[model samples]
Target: MELDDLIGIARARWRIIVAVFLSALALASAYVFLTPAQYKSTATVFLSINLDQNNLSSGSYALSQNVASYASLVTTDLVAKQVAADLPDLNLSPQALVGKLSSQVQQGTTFVDVSAQDHDPVKAQRIAQAAADEFRKEVQSLQTGLHAAATDAASLPIKPTSPKTTLDLLVAAIIGLLLGIAGAAIRDRLDKTIRTDKQVESATGAAVLAKVIHDSQASTKPLLTDIGEFASRAEAFRLLRTNLQFVDLDHPPRVFVVTSSVPAEGKTQTATNLAISMAKAGHRTLLVDGDLRRPTAAGLLGLDSSVGLTTVLTGQIDLSKAIQVHPESGLHLLAAGKRPPNPTEVLQTQATRDLIGALREAYDAVIIDAPPLLPVADPAVLASAADGAILVTRHGATTAAQLEVAAARLHSVGARIFGSVVNMVPRPDPGAYAYYMEYAPVANKQ
Candidate 1:
């Protein structure tokens, strides 16, 4: 990926990265604390060939070649056994002691370095010294004209060689940070939910008319009366009203269907609020709960839903008598009335089309709150009758695939797709929200 792509992923998924990093750091710290500390010490052994007066140059060359071979003998079982016997108080076996022993020839010299590691510094030094001594004795026994002797005694180590706190923590931190970035990149790749206005526009091939900020009080008070006009939620609806009017200049949509791909995506809420915002703007708006399968607009606005749309469609009540005006916002409401068994069949009839036509002539704007598009054919039918469909999708709740499917369903019926509404968007920062609220009233007056 390009640098810009990675940067975007980091910005969007920083929390996941931070969480993974902290977890890895914690694990590394636990390992450092629980693992035993190890101390290391080394002794140097010098190897030289016994030179005859006649062959001084040949003896020196032989010693240089044999120096590496002598270093290898330091790790032998014979050397470990001797060291173990010498340090019997430490209770290390020959096999176990061999694991702690190492040797290497010093470059450009006839010096063999023998090292040993142990939890205790004294033991490490004793083992290194004994291993050097034992290696020298083993070389003498070979009688190959080579002589070996300890040149430097092993020094006592005051600090541990393993579990270097600062270095270990630094390495751990780097590794943890890398893992966290990888995890965040993977998560961002896998997530398919709709999160931004751009994604909605791309998927639905329509502009995002509005982004409704999430409100905790919306469930108890669904209407704008409960949420003041100066609030962000009300401001969002106001923006929706303004955008809807400007979507089509010459032939603007006077009536439209508000629906989503699936239930609980806030389609009902969007329909209710948009109608109130339009009515508050002095437009004679009518909100019809066209979701005969499940009606909620009347209940949301505290209006009588017992005799409305279905009653008028069945010819049981006059259209004007069935429509109720919300006292608070002056928005006309036509409830779903008694749910019919055949909702799809009821909405597909000519009566439904005629009702939409009649409402379009009577009101400045008519918003029909329809059921989810995927589960039933009610919304597609309603959209076909109305001017267009305003698909309402919840932020992070509706997947791209679901939104695409809903848009395709609307397109199949040749329904006009005006635009989309993104619901329950994350609230802006507190300072920004307060600033907007403080100045919104003055902006409205202007």
Candidate 2:
């Protein structure tokens, strides 16, 4: 991924990253404080050769070869047993003493260092010193021409060495940061929710008309009829209405089926508000409740659903007698009336198509609030009878795959997708809208 993509993922999942990092640091802290402390002490032995001045160089080379062998003697069973006997207060067996002891030959020198580590500082020093003495005696017995002596006696260690606090914490911090970033990348890869306008446009190959900001009061008051003209929600619907006109300047769509990929994605609310917005702009608008499976548009506008589209289609009443008017927005409404047992079969009738044709001539704009496309075939059938469809998708809820399928279903029936609307976005930064509203016309502000 590019730098910008990484930055975006980090910004989106920072909480998860921070939580993982802090948990790692906490675990490291617990380990550092709970572990037992160990003190280390070291003792050095030097080897010298008894040689004549004529053979000085050969003697030095011989001593260097023997240095490594002497260092190995420090960890032998005999040396460990001897050291255990000398440090009786330590109460350690020969095997335990060998585990505590280590030896290394100084590079380019005939010298060896024996070290021991233990919880008791004084015992550590005694073990090192005893091991060095035993190694020295063993070297003397091996070669009479060589002399081995204790060069530096072990000293008492003042501090513990096992718990290196600073280094351990730094390593933990680096590992934690790397794990956090990897986790965030994995999460981003797995997420399939549609979030931005660009994603919807790319998936459906249609322009985004508007983004409706999330409102807590939207569930109770969904229509722009009750909201003021200057409110942000009303302004969003106005932007949608204006964009609809630009989709095709030559022959703009007069009747549109507003639906989504699934239920509760604000399709019903979008249809009602779009009709109100058109009426507010001095156009004759009519909102038809085309969803026979679950009708809600009539109740949303406080109208009577007892006599509507179904009543007119069944020859029980005329269209003029069944249509109700929303008092607040002056928009015409055609409720679904009573739901039928077979809604798909009902929407496919010739009468329904003729009603849509007649309504087109009676009104300047018409919005049909239809059921979700994926769950039922009602929206696709209605779109085939209407001019086009306007897909409504909820932010962080609808997946790109579902939107693609919905668009494909419409296209299969020769229905055009006018555009899409991204609904329930988080409120914008106040400064962003303030700058645009500053240049708004005076009449719009009122």
Candidate 3:
């Protein structure tokens, strides 16, 4: 893959990368600390010919020939047994002594090095010294006229040859980093959620009405227009309000039910903010809590829910008395009062339709906070009464399949869908949201 693609995958799944890397490093650390340390010791032997000055060159060639044979003999059972006899304290058999001993002749020279490796430094040194002594004796016993002499005796090693903590950790970390990156790339490829604007439009075949950036304070500050928190977020709602007006110029959608395929996708908040923005724009907007299953608009607006849509539907109170005006934003709130056991029947009634018609005539706009379409049919039913519906979906959380199903649900009931709103978008990448900056006026900076 390209560098940019790899970086994106890493950024998206950095947690997985960190987890895998730490796990690998921990295992490497355990191995480094638990494994026994090994020490290696070595002894050197030199082979030479005792010859006259006239035959010096020939004697050198003869020693060179004997060196190869002597080196090969060092690993023999005879030499190993002799080494065991030399190091009586070691109590090792010929086979065991040979396992720890290694012999190699220095190239272009009549010299050989015998090395031994073991967990104990003292044993390693003893083995190397005994193996070299045995090898030199064996060469003399061959009666080849070559004199074999010990050049240097084996000495105790101060440090170990294996269990290198730092080097092993470095190698392990590299492996872990590679594994983590690979896993992230695979996960991104397998992800089914629609994360980008192009994906949303491609899935629903509908223009995105608004892209609401994610805000941690959204729930605490539900009404952006309510508290004068006029920032880029507020401007997004205002732009949405303007775009809705332009959606159907001849017959603009004034009565809209904001909903999604599932709960907590920011539909209720969108509906609440949209109504407030409409009111801020000087439009007589009536925000109704149509979500009987989960009525939140009334509580968000701080309005009394003892007498509301239910009271009016039951003929216990007039629709005018059921409505409460927001003292801050001038937006009217009709809470889902006394949540009925059966919201489906309540919204399906002709009285509900009549109430919507009256509200549309009395007010410039009526935005209803309806229940999710997939869970209940209340949203679709309420949409049938309103001019159009606005679908709210959380970016990177809602799958393309869910959006398609939601759109189909509205279409099946013959309800007009004005457009879908992509909500809870990532706020970090302002570079990607340059288009929305045009609508974010200087007066709206938070």
TM-score of every candidate = 0.91, 0.82, 0.75
Better of 1 and 3 by lDDT: 1
The regions of model 2 sitting more than 4 angstroms off are 53-59, 62-66, 119-130, 137-141, 145-162, 213-238, 276-284, 299-306, 325-332, 424-446
Model 3 poorest ten-residue lDDT run: 435-444
Model 1: pairs clashing at backbone N, Cα or C within 3 Å: none
Write one digit per residue (lDDT tens) for candidate 2, span 267-383: 999999999999989999999999998899999999998888888999999899998999888999999988889999989999999999999999999999999999999999999
For model 3, what is the error of residue 325's alpha carbon versus the real structure, in angstroms, after optimal superposition?
1.4
Candidate 1 lDDT tens digits, 1-446? 99988887787778888898888788879878988999999999888777678897978987787778778888889888888888889899999999999999999999889999999899899899999889999988886777887889999999898888778888988988898889988988898999877789998999999998889988887778887768788888888889888888999889989999999999998999899889988999999999888898888888888999999999999998999999988999999999899999999999999999999999999999999999998899999999999999999789999999999999999998889999888775689888887887788799
Which candidate would rank higher by TM-score, 2 or 3?
2
lDDT of 3 by residue, 70-89 (tens): 78887889998888878788
Q: What C-alpha lDDT values do all the predictions have?
A: 0.90, 0.90, 0.86
Name the better of 1 and 3 by TM-score.
1
Error of 2 at 199 (Å): 3.2
